[model samples]
Target: MHRSKGIVIGFWVVTALLCLQMGFTAYAQLSMPEVAEAIAQLGFPHYFRKELAWAKLLGVVLLLAPVPARLKEWAYAGFAYTLVSALIAHLAMGHGPESWIYAVVTGVLWGLSYFFWRRLQAPSVGLRPATA
Candidate 1:
């Protein structure tokens, strides 16, 4: 069966939202004092903030752009890894479960976006015409 236009639009919408979220996160990490303080409290080096911000920004671009399929796959994987690691880090630091809610939500969004992306990539299967 042919893929529905609605599905494609939905995929794009989710991907766009994910991009916006990541962009905002990267910006906050790079410039927000509170975020820097939290990072320090977590025992991460000051320079890690900048590195993570840049990496997240790059991931957002890779997800949104019409890049190679492999690159897009890597972007999805990267976001998944980032979110999971964030949750783990929060838990490791003895932060309350509530502290990891953002990571959980983002992880769900990433999974949905990746599912739709893979669905869109799949070729439609239909019966072929019979030959004489």
Candidate 2:
């Protein structure tokens, strides 16, 4: 079955958004004192800035790659998990609402993308196609 145009657009949008978020998070690690303070407060001193940068970059690549459908689904699942984790981190660390904005958007975008993907899947042979 062909992918829906909406899903394709959503996939690109999510990829770009993830990249933008990665850039902002990476930059915050250097430019914002709050990032370091938050990290410290979270008690993960060894989890340096580079780790998050690399993870986000890798996640973006995985989501954008021309992998098998199953692999793509797995990538989306991973990305969703990461978004939720980031949201929790921000809330637990007392970061502003802005810090969790990406997480919220990512979650919504992923949900929409996944919904379209599922809707586009071919129906089983045992079932009759829906009549218009």
TM-score of 2: 0.64
TM-score, every prediction = 0.90, 0.64
* Pairs that collide, model 1: none
- Please give the CA lDDT of all the candidate structures: 0.88, 0.68
Off by over 4 Å in 2: 23-37, 120-132
Worst lDDT 10-window in candidate 1 = 123-132
Among these predicted structures, which one has the highest TM-score?
1
Q: How close is candidate 1 to the true structure, as a TM-score?
A: 0.90
Q: What is the lDDT of residue 101 in candidate 1?
A: 87
lDDT of 2 at 42: 66
Q: Which regions of candidate 1 deviate over 4 angstroms? A: 127-132
Candidate 1: tens digits of C-alpha lDDT, residues 11-112: 898898888888999999999999999888888899998998999999999988989989999889888888988899999988997888888888878988
Clash counts for the predictions, in order: 0, 0
